[model samples]
Target: MAFVPAPGYDPAYDPPVPYITAIPGGLRPGMLFYIRGTLAKGYTRFRVDYATGQYEGSDIALHFNPRFDGRDRVIFNTFQNGAWGEEEKKKDTPFSSSRPFELVVQITQANYQITVDGKPYHEYSHHIPMDRVTWLNVKGDIVLQAASIIGCGVGSAGSKGGAVGIPGGLPPMVGPVCNRPAIPFTANIPGGMIPKRTLVVAGHISSGAKSFIINLKKYSSNDIPLHINSRMIKNVLIRNTFLNGVWGEEEKDIQNNPLQKGQFFDLSIRSGDQNFKVYVNGHCLFRFDNRIKNVQEIDTVEIQGDAELAYVFF
Candidate 1:
């Protein structure tokens, strides 16, 4: 049976074996497919397929198959014209038995980048037209706890016109719809953050890490409306603004280091009429009064330094 997805939400969240669904925006550059699950104790092999439809014999653009019994390798290949392509195999297997796992795959113009946990895994270039692949099929020896697609940017999914039509509207947003972005990343705040815009920065602090910074600044000018700096050894989280290259007074009253080394953290910077509220793990951490009067003009957000960025949504 072809796996037709439910409207308004990705079917990856559905509870069932042989998890099947349609990618909200199809496979676009900058979108990400994330699967979090646990391999059964007697796991042998499993396949995650991105295909044209739910038909048993449809073409699959990316066939990510990991075998634990045969060769203990991860195989990446494609299916077209009812045949499989040459197998591209990796000797290492990051999946473990009786343990949780996280696999994030990022789509780009050139190729697909796969990452496990927080480290990069492999890169597979496109053989089929990326836009033609719209269905997501997952099956094999794993207890699928949660499967999701982040990074579905604006205007990419369920859009009408040409390549692939997203059946449901856009996938529901958990936040700003960002995929797995690499560290030292920078992107424009879509529609220029109006009041009540929530910006989230999430990642794991690297072991032996030093510091990291997340800043929201103007795209054309040098006015930094919000600057968040975290120092590990000094144990200080600094907040300030930089306008015309002149820095404002630093606010360092954060009592404890909210972010710990080797731990994952979810930090939020939400724009308000009078200030931007910052939260760590759902707790109100900092509130910076509106430094730049015109909030809609702050167009860019930048993250850099020591940390493995899991996700960034603006």
Candidate 2:
């Protein structure tokens, strides 16, 4: 499954070196993290850690260290109570200095699966409880470009016919996985909207685009619980609801518009108990309070207007 940056956790772009931040909601079995950076020329080593706390000397659940001193190797270990656990080493390194690289780390029940530049790299078994890992620390000689965390569904390693431990307690109803889906697309949100359920829409805006609309509607009625209209020409985003053949007041206030003409975007809408949180390109854009109390009735998603879609996942 293609993963967009998870809503509620902002993606870091061009972040400073030695970045340390809390992993919002912590590490769950289905969570995936993506990191992209360029190794500094003539670099010696660099490391990324999933830690229990942000402070130095805090226990580290997983330590991923790539070394380039005399022998190029990657070391994996755990740190607890001022001691390092036995090290697991991979002899070959998939990274090179002065080159850009993409690394993906996926959390599973048994191990951390690592991928480098789209290839399976290594898997390190858990030495510390994953739930205790609440922080991510990246340091050493690399220029970090981007880092994001996203949900890719539960039991991602293939468990059949069982309830997932996610908040909604339902198997992910991720759909069609369309590639470049035709404009004016619509899809069903099976089992209806519930708190902690997330919808992801990824695509590129048409160069001459003027506007686009995303609507969450009831499958059997004309009522729309949420309608998002983005007007590129006016640089405004409008949010409203339609009920009883009438539209509610429009919400136009936002921090800043993140949409632009001819640019790719990953838009996420995460349902919460009281409101819907909207994020674009990994940044929270705004929140819309629930106008319709019964969200389970909002079962259909419709998209239209001047944009080229990559995919829509619910």
Candidate 3:
């Protein structure tokens, strides 16, 4: 589900765009947050970012992409690079710019409940937890003016700590998973199997770095692939797939890996789960222990230098 914009929604003329805001790197499980804003004209994409001061980083987490009809409905689609497609608000669609609208959502250990303008709309359940999100963004020129967060009060008078397995007192998880502005890959990861490079399916295929990487998920394991990302998938496994180079040869390393200057890479998946845990050079870097669980299995791994992709195993 994609959206253009209302015919002429203006941010400056309308009330200041309410901020779709959240704390970065501190999302815990079981919390509620309020995201209120005006659907002023000219708003197209809505995204959430977690890495402060830096737009694109491997450390960033969660992004939500939504579309509006510019009439009477606003839709919040699910997943970044995986399936589950789009889900629309049931009660009060806020696609029209005629009046102001607000959306409030509660995240529990088991599911998510949404309320638009004080009325309940929909609830989604997940096996993984949603409490792991830290940053949020809204894109497509839409302006959000104000925002607030509410904590789940299960263990204390107003305790906002995440669930049992994770640490305590982390920020509420409202990270967005779609509508993110595209950032380019900064490192020249050797394509295909190159010499002196270890091959791994995740370093190339899991990062959403390019159109080719996106298409890699569709390649099948039975000499062809289908899907990847960490979610509720069990039983099936993917291993040792080879990178096909520009010459169709298993790629080999030659030059020092260098990306186009001013280019940066982003790590995100189509699944709503925030737990696409990543590591660099055998060191654990980012772990999205939140609820957005959609895992992928990769085969035929490849790499350029000293790096280990054991975490991609899920």
- Sort every candidate by TM-score, greatest first: 1, 2, 3
lDDT of 2: 0.77
Ten residues in sequence with the least summed lDDT for candidate 3: 3-12
Q: What is candidate 2's lDDT per residue for 96-187, written digit by digit as tens? A: 77456778787889999998866789999888887688788999988886775555344322111232334334335434344346878988
Q: What is the C-alpha RMSD of each candidate to the true structure, in Å?
A: 7.5, 8.7, 20.4
Best by lDDT: 2
Q: lDDT (0-100) at residue 73 of candidate 3?
A: 40
Q: What TM-score does structure 2 among the candidates reach?
A: 0.56
Clashing pairs in 1: 25-157, 151-179
lDDT for residue 289 in candidate 3, whole number 0-100: 30
Q: CA lDDT, every prediction?
A: 0.74, 0.77, 0.32
lDDT tens digits by residue: candidate 1, 1-314 = 12322222232432466887666557777677767778866889999998988779999999999999867999999999989999999989998885567788888899989989868999998988987887888898888755656644334444222323334332223344555578788888867777666676666678788888988989889689999988888888889999988999999887766776665566767675599888765567878888777988988999987887667765
The candidate that achieves the highest TM-score relative to the unseen native structure:
1
- Considering lDDT, which of the candidate structures 2 and 3 is the better prediction for this target? 2
